[model samples]
Target: SLTKTSGTSSRSTSQLGRHFHHRTPGNFLDPEVRAFLEENTEVISSGNLTPEIRLRLLTPRCRFWKERADLWPFADPFWAIYWPGGQALSRYILDNPNIVRMGSVLDLGSGCGATAIAAVMSGASHVLANDIDPIAGMAMVINCELNNVNPFPIAIKNITDTKLDKWDLIVLGDMFYDEHLADCLHHWLGKCIKMYGTKVLIGDPGRPQFTGHSIHRQLHKVIEYSLPEPTRRENNGLTSSIVWSYQP
Candidate 1:
């Protein structure tokens, strides 16, 4: 039942393999992108969350240049860093393996691939790391290789429109950033649960879109984690995060 009936997934994964040059590490995606990451990032095993995985994340010294300014605001450079919501979600899944074990997981808005990596490490049968940004997908691929985990499939497109009924679970970390996106996910995910009984887990550090409205009432707080020093710094001093089981 975890099988992807959507034909788009196959093509999306294929697109990730296109134009792959000689690899610096892992499957070659883009030589220039890989070079940028290699020069700017270091492989980190963030034991604060999932000690079993590693990621190639940006260094504090890495400069954000004018060339990439176009990507700002929309395709945020924030993907280069792990946020508080993702850190807590990853840790929860790792600690509670029965939640995702042998399940099909979709990590939506999967910045830095932290949630997807945790799902794989926790024994998910099928895990898809999805983001509209191809760079994030590439980053996910590299992280998978660094962890020496199973193959990671990525969908380099927006999936918020889809019902995603076939997936056993959908894990969203720090997704409620704006009202429009929040509305879309609230509708889409609510339908998924009603139609196919898809389970949803949301990790949030109290964004307005999540906590500022009635949507907060629908969520059942499952667990909470006090973010590590680094995560707090990246996330505007959010001291802690809560993992909520979305009961829409």
Candidate 2:
């Protein structure tokens, strides 16, 4: 079923779930939402993504962001903007295509699908995106289309509860924002490493929840980038972001 993290009514959820049919969300998009996003969001590229990864992203100047609750009373529009970490990671993927060549990749919490699109563009054999927010899930499909991604699919739920192994690589960007979510990721990600030796990559700008986790001991920096001017402005005054390799 389409996961509902907010107070949206069951009737409303049923209306939404009919598009997904009680499974991980795929390419299905409600026409109203497709039209709304196409109308409200702006087409732009992320920080330093060479060859230009275009995305339909929301800005504060948009109507929905300026008056969110009044305009769209669902979840916060986390997917509307590409987070700083995701931006840096997407650039890294474009610069270092060999890392994901012919591999299966999962872009966990793939808000805006920037990193996922990079994986596709970089030669990944297959790529799947996962995010809990249904709206974010829809936006990712639109983004993949914006980037001309190959037949993209998104699993629209929190998947941290599963052992979740077998991915050739799993990537996360700016996902370490919540305490409980951080702990769950620590346990689940550690098992993925120890049990399957799956490669993991993290892109972050030192969110407080990051260093406090057990996952901290396993990460080492691979590359860091100074944030582009526009990304810096939105990243809570952070000047840079880092991509860390996880080897357990």
Candidate 3:
């Protein structure tokens, strides 16, 4: 029942099928995926980010358990839940539309495409939402369509894997979860700055990787927010977030 991509193994295909119900190369335009998104997520006005625009997002019932790879399709729906970091960035973009006006924007780790969609709404000339997970990419597309934004593309891979020379602005949201990733981001973003003069912005909810010694050292805080609460009780206490300008 699983369909295979060009280089993917049979096992990987089976797992992807389980997530997209056997639709190989499933994209945001897939009718099945659109229906699934409609059933799994709720379309609502962003409570804290940009209350003016409605987005399709996950609620508490989605069970976003990020550690369980086996439950990747259902339980670990990171793309569904609107993290505090994303909320902060989305709000910042909306409130300061001029920041992205007429610019080319890239939203790395673009969960549900909130920031990318916000960038489009903010009058960016071009927007790309990139995520490591294929499901997240599809989710971004679906969210963009739900928000009535068009021409926004989703890339399912690491930002470093792509050619970033053409991009004018880079936005990262809640991506500083792991040490290795933070390290990689630090080096890659530094190169992006020196080589391309790309303006970088980051949104985080005080993730461990965004510590005082890590990415935080290079970030200048721009704005703070009381974002929407996570569904999980343990993650509930952390309601504050910050938007930072990356001086890489």
Candidate 4:
């Protein structure tokens, strides 16, 4: 006869033990998301945005990874809001060459690490890629590897807690969209530049708050590119790339 197991014995034998277990959904990738990924995989691998801009349908995967919330990264599809801006910023920085030299640089709201990769390529001694989304952090790691750049990942809850290591430059790309975020970021940026002597560079496509800021220099301007019908959202077709610099 088999030995009878007590309730305590059964509970102790189970993996859950005394704790309760909740079942969550697996695989967040939907059909649309998968299709978008498949379409842009090649373009992302190539690191070329010209064709993408012309096509206007290159959906970038920049979505936040919910499962890895601890990492705090931004998650969106590729070619989403920031990818184009990031590419434009990189191109402008490459063309100028004087703005980003060998120095400590930080890419705030790094997203998929496009600007950070550009910074590394532009000869920054060290690049810190920061984001509050774990998915974006993962993408940053992948993108950095693709571009042959090793970026330091910093998950920050707020810009106030950003490390004050006397960085030479801080790049903000497509971050000034909302009033609240823009205001908070602007305040932090002022502190970063005025107190730390860090050169603040911002890349925006004529967002509301972007216009409000007092810029020291407008370094470069890129023509607005139209997005494909499927991917076109608000301000999709009409957008101008502007690189503004501030020194405090």
Q: What's the ranking of the predictions by TM-score, best on top?
A: 2, 3, 1, 4
Ten consecutive residues with minimal summed lDDT in candidate 4?
Answer: 1-10
Model 2 lDDT vs. the true structure?
0.75
| Tens-digit lDDT track of model 1 for 32-93 | 77776676667777634655667777655555432344323223445676766788899999
Q: What is the C-alpha lDDT of each candidate?
A: 0.73, 0.75, 0.72, 0.52
Best by lDDT: 2
- lDDT for model 3 comes to 0.72
Poorly placed runs, candidate 4 (over 4 Å): 1-81, 213-235
Return the TM-score for each candidate structure: 0.82, 0.86, 0.82, 0.63
For residues 1-248, could you state the per-residue lDDT of candidate 4 as single tens digits? Answer: 00111111111223332121121112222343334333443333333432222112223343322223222111223322344455556666666556777788888777667777777677777777776544344455545555566646555334556565677888877776556666677667777777778887776656555566544233334334333332223345433455666553
**2 against 3, candidate with superior TM-score:** 2
Every model's Cα RMSD, please?
Answer: 7.8, 4.6, 5.7, 13.3
TM-score of predicted structure 4: 0.63
Which residue pairs in candidate 3 collide? none
Each candidate's clash count: 0, 0, 0, 21
State candidate 3's TM-score. Answer: 0.82
